[model samples]
Target: MKNFSEIEAMARMHHPDLDARLAAHGHLRTAQEIADIPDDRWLSTMTRCVFQAGFVWKVIEAKWPGFEAAFDGFDPVTVSFYSDDDVARLASDERIVRNGQKILATVHNAGFVADISREHGGFGRFMADWPASDQAGLLELLKKRGSRLSGMTAQYFLRFSGWDAWILSKDVGAALVREGVVDKPPTSKAAIARAQAAITAWSDESGRSQSEISRILALSTG
Candidate 1:
């Protein structure tokens, strides 16, 4: 398998088209590199994923400000305190998803965020206690948390929000195949090694955010 630096050089050569795809997705950060985003951006991403559960990210991006306003900037303290009337208003907002179920889930998730915050003194702390630094743990957490629009894809989105440290989802590996970035290598250690090399290279130069990487990787791979 190629080392990371060599892979980076190869990927940089192929990065122009990849970069275009990510820009179309509204990605503004580097891949798998979430060290600079602030707390509010993280919360916004979480809330936007709630809206984007079954929808497209571009659509969500277009109405993001509406979401921010409807959810009171995704402030757990403010959103968790939403009244029934507030729910009704949000559910009718045309600029947002306007789906009652998704709207309620966002409210419920806000409260859930509050609960996790109390239990661990902060939601970030709670996420840190998660076992298994892989997609399986993310899947189990989504299932247990009553996430309405969550699945493997959604879990990956959560991981992109800095909720996890790695992208161990099958979809992530499959993305390499879709992009023809890697051969249809066997699903053995060798194949995984090739995929990891591709990911490291892609992450280094594409200037895509993790969520954008997840989206493009999954779509292209599929």
Candidate 2:
């Protein structure tokens, strides 16, 4: 693969405003900041990502307050204990999207968050402590343990929750293919590992966060 600087130059050539666009997204949080995020908010963010999957994001955003209310502020301890009766109530509730599977996912993910919080003292701490170099491993953990948190959904949850994450968007995947990192979008274990190693190496060379590198790669493709 080419050096990150070369990739960045290619991005700049494609979009002179690349840096501006990236800056508008705001700075990533420090490890301490990430660690300080409350467990409830983590659950809330995860729920939002799950619900937004295969659905229009604007609709989800517009009704987010209803979601917050429906789930009682998404307190993991509370939502984890939601009963079947509660699920039925939410399924017919007009306040939110009322997708039964997504609602159940929220309940299960609350348990997932609560469990992790118990294990590590806080879910935020667990996220902060995870090494960015092994993001694939973290993704695997989410896929296996968390409900509806696989592939792009998991990646977006990490990004939206302020974890230093790289999203393997189509453009980024195409860039990776151009760099000979993989012949296609990485889905299998070995392919993903190879992609991860490439990004980790680029991070080491460029001193940029994986999220930033991911955006640059996407911009380079256009």
Best by TM-score: 2
Clashes in model 2: which pairs? none
- 1-222 in candidate 1: lDDT tens per residue? 334334334444556475565456443333324434443455666677776766787998998888887777888767778899999988788879888887777777777667767776666655555542233444556557745635544555555565533343566565566556556632444564555455545555665333554445544433
Give per-residue lDDT, candidate 1, residue 2: 37
Cand. 1 Cα-lDDT: 0.59
lDDT of 2: 0.94
Candidate 1 TM-score, C-alpha based? 0.58
Query: Candidate 1 regions off by >4 Å?
Result: 1-42, 129-135, 163-222
lDDT of 2 by residue, 125-158 (tens): 9999999999999999999999999999999999
Lowest lDDT sum, 10 consecutive residues, model 2, at 18-27
